[model samples]
Target: MFELRHVSKRHGAIIALDAIDLSIAAGQTTALIGPSGAGKSSILRMLIGLEWPDAGEVRFDGVPLRRETLLEQRRRIGYVIQEGGLFPHLTGASNAALLARTLGWETSRIEARLRELAELCQLPFAALSRYPAELSGGQRQRVGLIRALMLDPAVLLLDEPLGALDPIVRHDLQTQMRELFALLNKTVVLVTHDVAEAVWLGDTLVLLRAGKILQKGGIDELLDVPADPFVHQFMNAQRRLREDA
Candidate 1:
């Protein structure tokens, strides 16, 4: 569904991504996993056209991603960031329906879609009336998910959507997220620092370091055949974190 070929990006003196080539399959979930400065989030930013690469190209559904085509391409992509990225003043329902409303969708249609998403994401009907400030962390993330899925986009790009929640909430949402991905069957690219989350949620995992891809494959493949010592250290760091926990 998406492809990045020899992509690179830089911010002043800092290189965010370098010579990164990756592909995301249609109707499958892929995870970009790494520590800080690994360029995981940069990949999402490029995919959403928030930032452009200094070299190479980004393609969506076989078309080049350019400014002229970005608006139309974004319509088919759903994106969610940490803490929901919700507007502070808007009610959850209103936030979810903002795009649809802007697109001139009828109120009846918007309401119907909200109802469907509320059920699909297991969000409380009562909570939809609350603003972002009025909801718990978990609730806010669910509202974000609802907003992203509101348009029934063909691709889902989530950057640390569960990163801020408490453990219980993160665990609950992880299970729901897995189910949602399978149920929707949309191409999904998730950026996360959590190894277990990446392994559990992604059909394919791309491990990155220093703005470059270290390895990309299934969980077992990564564990069994690390590309370099950095890969081993990165994977073991997660294990140590769990052990410490």
Candidate 2:
């Protein structure tokens, strides 16, 4: 499990994150939803050790995050971002196997892992030979996901993973992602602005605003019993739209 205890971050005079406290369970998918500059990405970054907190600590499996343990912790966490974060010059297979090679995994083992992840992600075998430029947006994102999962990380952090794809592709990838996460049983933290996406993909939804947690719980819990007017309005808008449709 991942725990954030009174975690706060500041940049000069700007407070990027307030005294935030949250717990993320293993093998569950949690979506962080909010408007822009709400610090959703900041949370993800802190988890991956990209950004250090000015106060408090981020703990994984009861161990506090520290420089001495950063590398090992990172190796156990997978991160995906917009644009897939693939190397344009490398083939999909090379990209996926990069970490394995760096970790001194055997050639045969790397190939086997690539094949397994490709199958699990439902990516075509042909895509392994293709460069990022030659693949579609969805395909690139799939490769990016495969790269992250290549090591079978315990936790996956996704920052707007579907933001760059077209609607059709986004929907398809979303479905695939949910199924993949379920099968893998890896803890997932997804950051997105799309309300519907959050509802669809998350086992639990965390709403944030201005570096603070507004609400966090199951979708049904929030919908049926909102904490305040903002949540009430947000839930009602979806409910009314669905009712009208």
Weakest 10 consecutive residues of candidate 1 by summed lDDT? 236-245
List model 2 lDDT by residue over 45-154, tens digit each.
99999998999999998999999989998999899999789998999999988988999999999888888888998899789899999999998998999999989899
lDDT of 1 by residue, 1-245 (tens): 99999999999999999988898899999999988998999999999999999999999999999998899999999999999999998999999999999999999998889989999999988899999999999999999999999889999999999999999999999999999999999999999988888877889999988899999988777777889898878887676433322
What CA root-mean-square deviation does each model show from the true structure? 2.1, 2.1
- Model 2: which ten-residue window has the lowest total lDDT? 236-245
Report the alpha-carbon TM-score of model 2 versus the true structure: 0.95
TM-scores vs. true structure, each candidate: 0.97, 0.95
Q: What is the C-alpha lDDT of each candidate?
A: 0.91, 0.88
lDDT of 1 at 35: 82
Which runs in model 2 stand beyond 4 Å of their true positions?
237-245
